[model samples]
Target chain A: MQLITVAGPPSSGKTSVILKLIEAMQIAASDVGVVKFDCLTSFDHLRYEERGIRVETGFSGKLCPDHFFVSNIEAAVEWGQNAGFKYLITESAGLCNRCSPYIHGIMAICVIDNLAGINTPRKIGPMLKMADIVVVTKGDIVSQAEREVFAFNIRQVNTAVQVIFVNGINGQGATILASHAAKARSIQTLRDLKLRFTTPAAVCSYCTGEIRIGNEYQMGTMKRMEFKKP
Target chain B: MNDTDILYMVLTVPVGEIMEKHPVCQNFFKNLRIEDIERGLPLHQALEKADPETLSEFGLDRHAIQREFCDFLNVFAGRSDATGPEITSITIIGGHGKAGDPENCQITINRGETISIVGPTGSGKSRLLADIECLANCDTPTGRKVLIDEQNLDDERRIELQGRLVAQLSQNMNFVIDLTVNDFLKMHAGSRHSINIDDTVERCFVCANSLAGEAFGLDTRLTQLSGGQSRALMIADTAFMSTSPIVLIDEIENAGIDRRQAIELLASRDKIVFISTHDPLLALGANRRLIIKNGRISRVITTSEEEKACLSEIERLDARLFQIRKKLRNGEIISRNALG
Candidate 1:
């Protein structure tokens, strides 16, 4: 089954775009499978199941959802393959800005809305830098100039990627996005695959079940930024 | 290179010849302002004739300059002591079990072969590894004798081979030093006399990221790396920079890195790799596996072609279980089809 990873910041309409993409896929919807990965809680899978679309949700409570997603992604794809799916869509939480979930030799799309600010394209990490296609969502709420500027910002960071204005509300560009995702190469296994970029180093005391909230409470691979003397 | 080689060059080798062979040393000398003055003079002779005022300005005397030059080149120059030994094979002469019943097993593993030690918890799996690590000569509690080249390693040979010839990748790896990943790799590459530190560092970084579940930036502090990240980093470092011909890895199932790829990467590097693991993939992956019972080498089993044929089937089951485990961790409800 061909695999596609969708990542962006929280509340960036990733679920909307995915649902719209599946809607545009039409007959391919029955053969498509999706796994929603979120940090704390996710209720988006219910929407997919309602449309008779195969879906599952994974909640990474304390760890970064992207890390959880990548670590278990191969298994998710294996499940999709076993279920006889044609496409397996993995939607990442992208809670941590630096955590990139894209893998090499796979079709990966970044869902960024025009309302997240034009500078967000450059501010985002490799999630935007290494994407195969940048789907600009929420273009309905912004002016044409803002849409042009957002596309320009995306180009500033990644010039080669195809930027599509996918309005998640009415599914305006979902067909184009779905065709791009459909053109992805069929992945037999993720065993030899490579992540396009590295996720952030994590697992502090809190990650290992630390409950307290203080400097003394913090432990385990903590990052302390070093600043030069003024 | 070793200290003796560098010292020999500094003492007698002509400046022009040294510069031609090691252009890096020229940069070091130029940066330190320790010029090899005469066109035909050796480093020592030129340093002796340096102006006293110039030497003091750089905060050094003739003796210190000569000494500093050796130390600088020692870290930056290529390794010349890497010709210590060509370890073709490692033989483990078995020892007694917990009951001291004179356990008898003689196993000889050749270079580029992978071996795994398997047994129950506290079955002396690690003890057998420790004997190999220290190259035991019936000296340890297990009374196991580990031989290099089928011959017992003497004290002098052991001392010469201690840290440089054997690399032990133990469980519970964490970086204590606070340095960037790039700097850490650079330090290792510098001491190893890597042809290109930048290229080596990049390769190590990419390899580590591939092995690790999570990727870390080159500038990421060593201390901030997760358990998996640090272990993957070390695996990559050992694979690329280590000159050690023999590698001993403790149980690596819980390291969060890809165990199969880790084994493959190390074994492909032309090293005799010995791993102690409880995981079936690792045990079956090895060319031969040692069965430990009650702190003794109970049996030695060479993996047959038939056993090797079952690996792919096992991999399929492993992938299935892997997905189930992911679902279990995600608090998702399992349907009947999850097993399929």
Candidate 2:
């Protein structure tokens, strides 16, 4: 089962988009699983239905939603895989992205409200970097040029990423968004790449040198020629 | 490369030259801005004997060596930044030395993750660690307070902080409540900062052929447990249950239960764990070590990056001590064969 997380700032229409996506998948003859992490209220199935989707909630803990949420997501995905479902969508609680563990083996989609550029970096930069794709919701509110600039800024932080502009309320670009998530064979590649990029450079054992490139012997001076590329 | 190449490298290469030349060998010497190799050659020659990698079969490349040095320096930098009493210098106002002087003694704890305060009877190792602990608690005569991440803890918060934030496992391994194994874990699971008790408890018996809950009955009481069993339970509780950022352990093998459990515990994680002990096995488990003489911390010796760098030395000494100790305990079972 492929796990897809719909994460975004508060009131970014994550729940609305998730329901719309779930409804679209069900209509397309694909069984889907959904899990909403309620950090405040205990998990309630009735509350989930009231919010407009079939789900299980009420897992209690002090841990950030991402930590425990991922576990619950994995368990739900296992069930979905056994039940022959095509996808499982997890809607996370709105919080700063740094507290959460980067989910491995799953696609991360950051849903943003298109009308605002001020909240772009502050609310979304770190989370967008974690995402394989950025979904700009409320596409009808923002002009075509504004959407292009938002996508461009996201590309500056993360060079290679797919950005989908969708209006989930009216079902505009909803099929395209689901298609991109379905095509995300494995998100582990992006996660692993980020780890290598963030980790500090390895220090040289001899002479306590911080060698960035070339072989150790040939690192600094012209005399030494042999240096291994890491 | 194979074992023979590794062996040849160790036998043929001078430690200092290897240390200097191996890590981007050309760049290292080049960055020094030296015209002649002979000018800065002495330091490498002196370090020739100190080359950490000895086995030729290991085939550790220059990159690995450089990585280790960086890790070593980073550990030191972390210790300095934390600047807890365990790594700091301490002064004992009065403690008589058997071989030497008697008053105003200073010792520097300068190695590994632990600062083992050791000396003969009345040598005041306990007094030193106690003073450091007290200092860590902000109990100095100058009324200085210890703040973790700039948050000042009051008396009640300090006690709570001491129990939950900083776990201190003294020589006495006694629990007041006669709690069942499951009940004890359940209680601690609440107190734990962020460690998943379910994951850790399950991890303990992951290797067992049988189920953890079934193999080790959850109803087992603390008092009914054997020395090794109690040590394992407590170690698991301390390491997994408590969320204490800093762990202060006094003489882990003081009563000599099963030290392998404690050794394994120390080997994991990047937490600020400080243990005081004369046991070489426990001391050697540290990444950064400190030698505490009298009330002052003396030399700090940080181990190199090789996994189990201090293992051989500690293991050799421990083996000798264990042999001598084996005579005292009549047919003592060191390792317990269990399903749990």
DockQ of each: 0.01, 0.02
Q: Residue A31: error of model 1 in Å?
A: 79
lDDT measured at residue B326 in model 1 versus the true structure, 0 to 100:
68
Q: What TM-score does each prediction get for chain A alone?
A: 0.91, 0.67
- Cα RMSD to the true fold for all candidates: 26.3, 26.4
TM-score (chain A only) of candidate 2: 0.67
Cα-based RMSD of candidate 1: 26.3
lDDT of 1: 0.75
Q: Which candidate leads in DockQ?
A: 2
Candidate 1 clash pair list:
B1-B78, B1-B79, B1-B80
Question: Alpha carbon lDDT of residue B44, candidate 2?
Answer: 35
Q: Residue-wise lDDT of candidate 2 within A1-230, one digit each (tens)? A: 56677677667777767765654343332466566666666433564467444565534244455556544655665555666656667676645544332464467777777655522633343466557777777755432223434554554334445666555665444544554565544321222222211211223333244445556444422333468998
lDDT per residue for candidate 2 within B176-295, as digits (tens), equals 345676665554442221235466555442322121112355677755665545555555555544443455666657544546445445335323556667766666566556555543
Candidate 1: TM-score of chain A is 0.91
What does candidate 1's lDDT look like per residue over B1-340, in tens digits? Answer: 6888888888888777877776556644554445556637787777767667656644457786667667656644544422325788888888799998888999898878899989898898766765665566675667778788888776678644543456657664445546788887776565444667799899989999999877799999877988888889888877776777788787777777887898889888887888988888888999999998999988899998988899878878887887787688689999989999
| Model 2 spans with C-alpha error above 4 angstroms | A1-230, B1-115, B121-124, B131-164, B191-200, B204-217, B254-261, B264-267, B303-340
lDDT of each: 0.75, 0.48
Q: Candidate 2 chain A, which ten residues in sequence have the lowest lDDT sum?
A: A193-202
